[model samples]
Structure formats: C-alpha cells, structure tokens
Target: MNRQQKGWQQLFLFSLLPLFLAIFGASGWLWWNWAISPAQLNAAKPQQIQIPPGTATQQIGTKLEQAGLIRSKIAWDLLARYISSQKSNGGFQAGTYELSANQPLNEIAQTIWDGKVIQVSFTIPEGWSLRQMADYFQKEKGWFSSQDFIDAASQIDRKKYPWLPADIPFLEGFLFPETYQVTKERITPQAVVQLMLERFEKTALPVYQKSQNQELNQPKFTLKQWVTLASIVEKEAVVQKERPRIAGVFVSRLLKGMKLESDPTVEYAFGIRQTPDKPLTFAQVRKPSPYNTYATPGLPPTPIAAPALESLKAVLNPESTEYLFFVARYDGTHVFSRTLPEHEAAVVKIRRERQR
Candidate 1:
C-alpha cells in the first residue's frame, strides 16, 4: 500500500477505537442501571407512587426517576418503549403502586405492565362502636364520610340480613370487626356497612348454631342476647384467653338475675362523644339510660360495640364456672373472682398498685 493510504487507514483506526470504547461503556452503563436497584440498600420501606390515568410513559419515567425508584429515565423510557412495541396494551395502569428503591428496572416495568394496583386494607379493630367506626372512616384520608356511614348503618335493617336476629332493635352488634379491602372510587359508606354485616353473618351464624347444641341443657338465649353478651365480653376482656372466662361470669350473673353493672354499657349509653377512656366517675356510672347495664336488668337493648368472632364464640360457649365478678388490675389484665369479698379485695389491690 502507498504511504498516504497507510496514514489514512491509521487515522481511521484510531478514531474508530474511541468510538467503539464509547459504545461499549454506554452499553455497560445501561445494563448495570437496568439490572441493579436505584433505591438505597438500607431502605426499610417501599415508597408509594400514584400513577394517574392517562399518564404517558415519559411522565412515568420522570416520576420514577424523581422518586429515586429508577436509576435512569432514559433507560426506563427505552425499556417502556420496547415493551410497548412488543405487547398490545403494555402500559402502566392508573392506581397506587408500592415500589421499592432497590428493584430491577425490568421487574418494575413488568409490574407496571401487569396493572396490579395495590389493594389497600383497613381494619376495624375489635370492640369498636359504630360511632368510633364512623369517625375512623371520616378521619382517614379519602375515606367515606362519618355522618354518611352513621346514616347508612342506621337505615340498614338488621333483620333483613339472614345472619342477624329479626327482632333486634338496631345493627350495632352486627357490623363485625375485620380487615376490609378498600379499592379506589368503589367503596361507599353504605357499601362498607353492608359488607361488614354480611361478613358478620357469614362468620357468626355457624358458631351460634354450635352454641345452641352445646347449651341444650343450660338456659337457652336468643341470638340477640348472645350478641349482646358477646359485645360486653369484647369490651371487658383484654386478654384473648380471658374472653370465655369473662363471658362465663356475665352468663352466671344473668342466670342468677343479678345486675351486669358493666362499665362499657354505661359508656355506650353516654354516646361516643361523652364517653371517657379513663375510669368512669360515680355520676357517670349511676346515670340512667337504656344502655346502662348498671341501671337496666338483663342484657342491654342492643350490643354496645362490634364484637369479634372470638368474643361471639366466647359468649356462645363460655367456660362453665361459678365466677361472677372481675376487676381491672394496674396492668392490662383483669382479676376474676367468685365472691363479692374477692372482687372487693381485687379492687383494693388494683387501687393500691395505682397509688404505688
């Protein structure tokens, strides 16, 4: 070859070497960014991102990049484009999604394409009253209104539901406590109440029937009475093991024709607003109301709160015992007693512990 041609060839080779190196480095960077997570290695919680409807892929990439969920918008955008080209309807759906920082870019893209919107769950804790439940819905962000829930609950005919008693005055005891899935723009106050009632029937009816068989030799009570006693036990028992024992005490009291004198019943009479979490005053306990077990005989007209399945089962099949009294100790537990003197002694011990 001529000298001029050789010189030109060497120049070309040097230029192409730099170009090849640049291409190789860029490819390596892209591969690493796509496979490794951008989230901090020590991040304990996944960040939640809301992808609104009609959001384009470019916007999604930008959002993910800004949220530290993706290492590169360019890489994510390219992957999303590739996905779109490959599959029909390969786009992110509008809903809440939980994204961990350290997830692979390909995994995230696949998740988005899957359109699996995160299902949010809300739990109605055991022993929560209707008013408390209503307040919770109202207070929670994007939840149904409290007044709307209360109105819906009131209007629901408990008897119409096959699971509940036909003669019960209201639906207080039938809104079973449970974790409910809340979907976007789907659940309403009325819908939630209905769901809870349905769940209650599905869960409690079989237990009630079983109780009927077990207590055939004992005094038979209606479903309403069983629910009422369960509600009382729900509020009274903090320890899971003590629920049946507490129910037994209440049952024994009812059989002997003695006053229940339950503090939760008194609180229910005062309504949720006036009820105090601290110990009730003498005046509050003595106040006259239909719900006040201290003033009225037999079970209260209706349940004071939503009882858990455990509480319902406890009432239906209470431990057979002669115990008739209980007092709260300084701790979360309670001391049960068979006699007035024993109960009085427990009360004194609790008071002494409080003083100390």
Candidate 2:
C-alpha cells in the first residue's frame, strides 16, 4: 500500500475514536440511570400498588414506571428477562406491593420476583362481637363490607371446621380475636373468617380440650356454655387481674340458678354499648330479648363477644369465691359483693363518686 493511503486510513480511524467514546459514555449513563440509580432518591413513603394476576413482565415494568417507582420500563423488561433466564421459575408475583421510588430497580425487581407481597394486618380486640369485627373490617381500606363478613361468618362449614359446635347459630365467640396477617389477594371476608376460625381451633380450642379431663370437680359446662361465660367475663373485667374474679361471680350465679344480670348482656340485646357517663336504663334492662340476662335465666343462645385466652382460662378455672354480685366502678375495676344489698350499695356509691 502507498504511504498516502495508509496515512488516510489512520486519520479516518482517529476521527472515529471520538464517536466510539461518545457511544460508550452514553451507554454507561443509560445503564446507571435505568438499572442502578433510584427514580427519586428523596422519596419519603412507599406506595401500595397492585399487580394483577397474569400480568406480563413488560406490563409490570410499565406500571412501575407509571407509579414513579422505576426510572425506565425498558430497563425493567431487560432485568426481568435476565432474571428469568438465570432462574428456573423466575417471574414477578401477583398481588399488592409496597414499592418506594427511593429503591433501586434491581431491588424492586427482586422483591416482585421473590413473591414478597405486602402483608395487610388486622386486629380484633378481645371481647369484640361479630358486629364489631365487621365494622372494623369495613373501616379498613380495601377490605370487604361489614355485611359480607357477617354473612360469611354466619355460614359455618362443619366439614371444614369439625371443632365448631354443631348448634352454633353463627360464629360469635368462636372467631378467635387476635392480630391476623394476610396478603391482598386473600383479603376477602370468607378468608378472614376462615383464618379466625382456624386460629380458634389452633389456640383457644386446644385449651378447652386440655382442660376437659382436668376440671373434674368444676361444673360440667359444655363448650358453648364455657365460651358464653368467658365472653361475659371478658366484657365485664376491664382490669386483667379481675378476669378470674368476674368469671367466679358468673359461675356462682349459674350454680345458684340466679339471673346473671350482666349489663353487657343487656347492651348486647339492644345492640348498644354503654359508657360510664350513660348507664343502662331501667327500660333498656326490662326490654324483652332472649339475650337480656336480667330478664332471662341461664346463658343467652350465643356468646355476646369473642373471649380472649385469659378470659377463656378464667372460665376453665374460676376463683373459689362465694361472691355472686358485682358493680363496675367505671374505672375498669369492679366492686364484688356477697349479697344483693351490698351490690346495690356499691352501685349507689359508684354513682355518687361519678357525680362528684
């Protein structure tokens, strides 16, 4: 080759070097922005986003981008494909996710790929009734309606839960009260009720079963009767230490064939909750309802509320006391009395204290 041709070739190569460098720099920048850097480094909170079932990787990327969680959909598509190629069953899981814009693209992709869906938590306090649970779920975002929970709880499948009492009209105290966690996909009323029932079978039912042979000397109360008494104790005893004492009072009343006269029973009958400022009225107590303990003998047809583990335990082993009467002090403590006159005097004293 001639010297001039060789020199021209070298110049041509030299000129193209700038273009190669520019291309390399641009590629590096794109990789950093799309795959490495966060969309918003200062993002404060995470946003809950739902990934519908069977959503494609490309569609998921688009959603992430739209939700301001990812810098680029194209980058997500490439990353997801790479992950799928590397792993046998690598795919984004479907369900609700809590994603933050501050998270890196790879981290977010891995979260979805690993099926780490956001777990929603709901808590049912001890002594809460089925209606209260329904109302609570209604208040929670994205949960089923109050009526849905009530209806689902009402339909008890004996085959699935053989531990449930056959004569139960509806799942009242049987739906164990505790904090439960479930994914967004399993947030239906039926699912929640099943979880509660299962928890009851696992926790509360075992306690009752274990105590069956142990409480030989105690009153032979049926499972439903025990739960009914426990629920009453749960509602009556606000102070934790007083649970056994309250339960003893109810057991004594039941033994003597006397009316329970529990204020909570009257509230349950009328579907009302009374506070210290507003006590149960004479008319309300006299209101003719099967659940009105003041007017009815023995336990109501069903439990008025869900009993806690302690309350259930209290019923199993009540304190050996002769006290059959009690009045709430409005300060979570109760004044126990052996006679009706003492109870009336305690009630009068409580009323005077509240007035002062």
Candidate 3:
C-alpha cells in the first residue's frame, strides 16, 4: 500500500462512480419513457375523428388516447393550457372537429378550439310534411331510410301517441320542421320524430296544458287534439306569423260545426300525402276518406304531420277573427272570410289573382 497506489485506487473508484451513476440514470429514463409514454400514436393514425360539441376534456383526452392520437391525457391538458395561456380569447370552439393519432397535442388543441368540424346541416323547412321530410332524408346519401317516408310517418299506434285520436288515419302534423344536425348512425325516422316530439312537448305541451287547466264541464281535448289542429295550421298557413291565426280560423270553424275545408286534408288523402307533386281538384275533395277534411266534419283520425312551435302555439292560442273560410291568394298569402258570400268573393279574388 504505497501512497501513490492508494491515490490511484481512489481515483479509479471515483471514475467508476460516474459510470455506475450514468448506467443507473439511463436505465431509469428508459423505463419511464417505456412505461409512462403518451397516447399510442399508431392507434389514432387510421382515422380523423370529429370531437363533438360539449365534449368533456377528459372524454376528449380518452378519445385521443383510444384513437391513438397522444400518449397521455396530461399531455392534452398541458397543450390546452399552453394554448389557453397564449394571448387568445378562448382555446377552442364547440363542434365536430377532426383529429388523428401522431397529431401533436398543440395541433389537436388548436383544431378543436378552431372547430374545424365536419358537420352536415340538415334543413327541414317549417311547412314540409313528414312524407316530404322522409323523402328528403331518403334522397340524401348521407342517411339511410329503411322504409318509405310516408308509410313510416303514417305508422303510429294511437295508444302510444294517446295525444292522438283513436279514429285518426295518419299522423301528419306531429313532425316539426327546422334545421337539424342529424348525427351519424344516430339518425332515424323514429329518432327524428322523437326529437321533434320532444321539442314539441317542450313548447307545445305547456300551451295545451294551460288550455286544459282553464276548462271545466267542457270535454277536455287531449294534447293530441291540439297537435292535430296545429298540424292543420302548419299546412294551411302560408306564413309562420299567420299560423296562430290560421289555427284560430280552424277553431272557429270547428266551433261552428263547419268542415275544415282544408286543402292539406284533401292533399293528405286524395292529392298528395306521400307525393309532394300532385294537383288537387274538386273530385278529390269530394272523395271519401277519414283524412279528407272536405268529407270528414271533425279532426282527422291522427295528426296529419309534425307541426312546429309556431303552429302549436297558434292551435293553443287562436286569433279573434270572424273569418272561417280561407284560400291561397296566389301571393303566398291567404284570403279569409267569415260568411259564404265573403268566402266566395275571396275565392273569386284568388282565382283572378291566379289567372293574372
């Protein structure tokens, strides 16, 4: 044990210490990287998913993880935070946005926030019948229809829709018209009707209930009656703002024991319940059917179609007018008259306008 040898031995030991530390540190780093890596980049590589509006951050993170976009949820949050911290108003907009695996957390956040969504806007006009709606849906390659729209729309168990009458032939006025998102694999005629019914229930039912609450001794009409009337108004009225007035006119006529004489009722049976393009003639009005308002004195067996909130509101609260008979004035407006003479005059005026 010479002093020089002892010094050399100590130096060797000290040199070995750094090597051991390096090996241990490297192993630990490798383990961490292997065990705690972020989302599987490969998993998300195959598809670009649209993140839906109102998706929870955790759900989005899980989706990313499942989709193999990122290695970890923490990374997503970190990225979101980094983006949020930037001098920007907000991080993202709510929509169906596309994403895929291997996409950086920063890009994901920006895309989601930027709301580069793949959404198809489905527009259902306010006055379109369920048959028309169904036909429109059938034509869209985006959606699949299992049955004819008219048949689908007409198929209803009055027991299920007790809001409907027992003798009703077709349920027409129950379908609400408005723009809808129509989610993928989630769209169906039944679903469409259910959504419309739910929306209608939200807005129309309250009014019907209020009306029910007011009367005693008078045979209470179920919500179905109101829906039927609303459907009539929706089809009969040329304009939205005129829906309630149209409903009021029907109500007035009904109270007076008069036939609805509604063209839609004629259309529903003889003219065009399923077909949008059909001419209505006096012969069709004279044809006998439960849906023919010209033939049947009371409400048809069921709602003719789904009605919007405006029509529903009109049914629940009608305008105070002496008029009952109404005809299209050929100017997208209607001519209303109380008596037969007035109605005849209005009809002549409409005919003249049509000829012009």
The CA lDDT of each predicted structure is 0.81, 0.88, 0.68
Per-model TM values vs. the true structure:
0.66, 0.80, 0.64
Model 3 lDDT vs. the true structure?
0.68
Worst 10 residues of 2 by lDDT: 35-44
lDDT of 2 by residue, 223-252 (tens): 999899899999999999999898888888
- The positional error of residue 192 in candidate 1, measured at the CA in angstroms, is 1.1
Question: In lDDT terms, how accurate is model 2?
Answer: 0.88
Clashes of each: 1, 0, 25
In angstroms, how far off is 203's CA in candidate 3?
3.1
Candidate 1 local lDDT, residue 155: 77
Over 4 Å off, model 2: 1-48, 56-78, 81-91, 100-102, 139-142
Top candidate on TM-score is 2
